[model samples]
Target: MYPINTISKGGLALVLAAAALGVPLAAAEPDDGELWAGAESRIQRHRMADAVVVVRDALGRPVEGAEVRIEQKTHAFLFGCNIFLWGRLPDAGMERAYRERFAALLNYATLPFYWGSYERRRGEPRHEETERVARWCQQQGIVTKGHPLAWNNADPPWLPDDLDEIRRLQMERIEDCVRRFTGLIDRWDVVNEVTHFDRPQFVTIRAPKHSAMWERVGQIEFARQCFRHARAAGPHATLIINDYRTDAACERVIEQLVDENGRRLYDVIGIQSHMHGGVWSNAKIWEVCQRFARFGVPLHFTETTILSGQQGRGRPRSTPWRSTPEGEARQAREVVRFYTMLFSHPAVEAITWWDLSDYRAWKGAPAGLVREDMSPKPAYQRLMDLVRGKWWTKLSLQTDQQGQGRLRGFLGDYAVTVTAPGKAPVAKDFSLARRQTNRWQIVLP
Candidate 1:
């Protein structure tokens, strides 16, 4: 466990209040010197808000209905995991199983756009296959986002070694993706891992080809340019500058992008919490959110990974990782705890697990929600319980004399059913989008 360097001042007070109400808050002091603090305070009591919907007759008059049922088909919270390997599955059955697990629990998905893989040969991109998957996700009512439009590591193999050409090509790549996917997959990671450009890992030691590009154009400018290009290509897209860094330096990069009028360069802040080192302490997680919340932009846990396996030897990035029952149980608990913290935080809009299955997990670490055999691990079951069970909304009620049905629920897409005495049942579809009243006036013929 990492030491808790920062703590939210209000957390203790909130915890005390919850304790006074007889709510049990679990706080564990892990052997790794990390304190999982304020678990109970993080559990939000008011995730569902009041939504008033009125059933009306065709003539715009309120009509009493015998039965009213509201079923949430998807979440607006953006529970997502990467589907990078979904198209690569050799076995059709395995692919179906993977898609089933994904569609069952997730409403948002991250598709791979690593430049090298997306366009292995110059001038030829596998847009047909990519578009095919995007359409499939749309059919399932799932929103899709391209993993990265521009990255230091997303270098195509066939590209020339010239630095200027690389820079030009990078911008072109961003333009191509945004133009091609446009509305189908508008949200994008316009630039990834920019903070590490000047770090030793990138500049001096084991420098990737992107380091030269970074050195030439300057790190921050390159990122800004990427966002500009992506925005130009997909004017309505949500562009984000995603980084693995969560410290003050990362915040400064965001701060610098703001102008005198306090306008932000990116629409969303993408923070990666790949906790292969260990699950972040509740204090650290909360603190990070508090710091980034100052930016006044929605935060997305863009590439999250919590290992269900033993710590690897030597450096944090290790291979051939193995999973154990004990590790799986620990992983499950942390998943619930951390997710609760993120969901409760007012600034967080999305949280996406880096990879979906352990078989192809980065560096072979057991960081997947499911096992290689496609069986869900304890972590998967626990996540499902939270997303589809505890946090889900399902209701059956009747309209009052005014033909108004009062109800509250988590925000998202919903399926509505209306029935009247001696009349055929009517089915309708509605969405409880962000803001507004979420109130609807459904008419019966």
Candidate 2:
């Protein structure tokens, strides 16, 4: 196996009445096997079904030279979750539990890079904390990614009145991040939520009148400059243009990013699927994918969250968003379906679930796969069933005359065991990257 390379949900309703009246209602959980099957159909669809490998005997001889066969087992997928909690949880037990649980399931994590938080005061960036998180993720074999090098929501407080200086500083910020995180964390949401500046209420934090930065330098230009700076610094990094809105305006921004020669300014198209209100219909989900797929670029569902509690109906923080048994059950079902849809789409490369625990989740909503107490919720187990349990690849096969055996399975890292008459079994590791043919040679003992 390649060395551990340091890389770097929906719910709703009905329960509100019960909670108000001090009564509870039960929510139905989808059949585990059925959900797994649906997810498998998408995960192992046309894109990934089989891998071709060759097994050699103890003497470094192929089946053609010495009869040999092998057994293969898939260990994990590149599936990921976000760790935006400044790299540590509150309670010691919770922190250990959180990291352990997170490492068990996810191989990727999205680190926070909000401008306001990282550099609330210019020249005093919070690098030490973020670096700690990135290193921890690396030690756990999880790839780390930085989010939104440029975002209006997390705008710095010490901006000058000059638009040119603001633009210059924004580029400088991107440069500093890409340079600092060169290999520690390469993937970045170069520009986030760029599609909707007019939606005043959507801004998560303070913003100047008329959204000064984007307006001063045309929105498109501002985005282009951010990407340009990021690309210059971290050419190997996966630069993404992300947004929460899936409207015509977003599509236009996507189209404008490509050059006259059809070269794109960004590497990935990031879409946020915050299902706090409720799960989106399959048709609507497909429509959004098809719309973005038109750009012919890889897509990443950057920030997805589904509540395991009563939705806040637009005031998630002020109101109570308690998780009920019914709500969690429903969340499990919807989360499975949502992930299945995204995985099946050929254009999608990754999906980062927004929150891991309900504790201090965005706006303090119960949107985590795990409860605050560090117990696995139905959604968490359901996802595990799809990713590592049912959809995983494990099988034994015999090699043909050419010392070759074909194994059809999910895309991930695999452990191959080779055994032959009078020869002890030997193990070898190989990986199946998405859309790439994986070939391996395993020598027996």
Candidate 3:
């Protein structure tokens, strides 16, 4: 496992106590600016590993001076965007552009499974549509995650008024989705936004029927039941409890989402950061990481939105928001910074951008990495530079006298080609991850 070099809970409490008492704690901690400046170093220390590639002949003789080429294929850490536009674009050209750009940059795709839209009618869900998208994602080597198996955000219009029946159907839906997509999509946001499931604003106006059903079942009980059903269905799946709030409210809900045996139900903790209002400060981002790291589960920034438009004050639908040149520039800079911080933090395993394009983004806000016309934004290019260029590893090396070539590179899937003088080129694929031994042997033909 990758070591987390952050302060422990006890140490953090001591630091807090010292601060409260106006006492100095050994050395001062780095500020936000310092953290940003040192992000690259942190990334190198945490996100990379060293591997020794050994080359030999079929007779087990060391083949010294062999030329070896290493190239990265995919990231173990998921960088994703919602594939809500998979085949839903306006035209074939737009669809083609979307697929090309998405596959070029991202190795993770979030498939939409919103209850209201996914299954508009009872007993009939959009399984074929979702399967088509999942198949495409598999073909492109992208990991697929279903967004929200359970949420009070919206309910199907065909939902029944009986609370008991609603609960049964909800659990059945969770199990069905999890069981059906077991291998195709092994990750899920099991229960979404339970911290504010019955918030007055949402319960009254947004999803009254769903909220009422959730209330009757009780918040913690609802989450517990949903997680249990999901776990039973997809035992090997990475189930997550997702929430928008980063405060104590979220922590409370997560703390209580345990089985009868006191074991946590979720495999990951999903945090939503919709920055349509504004980008979160560096300090806030780091604080969120620290807060969630205590759960001992990987953190997935499930639905992140860094808008490439002027910040508006009213409701998203009511406001006329458009992406501008200046805003795109700022978005590019901040996107790099935000992603770097998250990537540097050890607890964060994945980061999923909200929308891939602004064509039909949530709330009609301009929050896509690409524009409405399927053109790349500055943010898109800058992120590509980081994810595929700077963070990616490509190298050429010669084996030493011991027939070993050593390299330190970012942890991910890699392809290696070894060519010795007067010998056929030999190629092999390997993966570099934290938990596994990274040594590989390539026997030349």
TM-score leader: 3
Q: Which digits, one per residue and each the tens of the lDDT, describe model 1 over residues 247-363?
A: 877866876665446677799999999888788876677667655665556789999988888854223444456788998999999899889878866568899997888877787
Ranking by lDDT: 3, 1, 2
1 or 3, greater by TM-score = 3
The Cα RMSD in angstroms, rounded to one decimal, for candidate 3 relative to the true structure is 4.2
Each candidate structure's TM-score, on Cα atoms with residue i matched to residue i, is: 0.87, 0.84, 0.93
lDDT of 2 at 161: 65
Off by over 4 Å in 3: 1-29, 313-319
Error of 3 at 224 (Å): 0.4
> Taking the tens digit of each residue's C-alpha lDDT, what string does model 3 give over 204-266?
876788888889888899899999999999989999999999987787788789888989999
Model 1, C-alpha of 65: deviation from truth (Å) = 5.7
* Candidate 1, residue 20: lDDT: 36
In model 2, which regions exceed 4 Å deviation?
1-42, 57-77, 201-205, 260-262, 316-319, 398-403, 433-437
Check candidate 3 and list the clashing pairs. Answer: none
List pairs with backbone clashes in candidate 1.
Answer: none
Q: What is candidate 3's TM-score against the reference?
A: 0.93
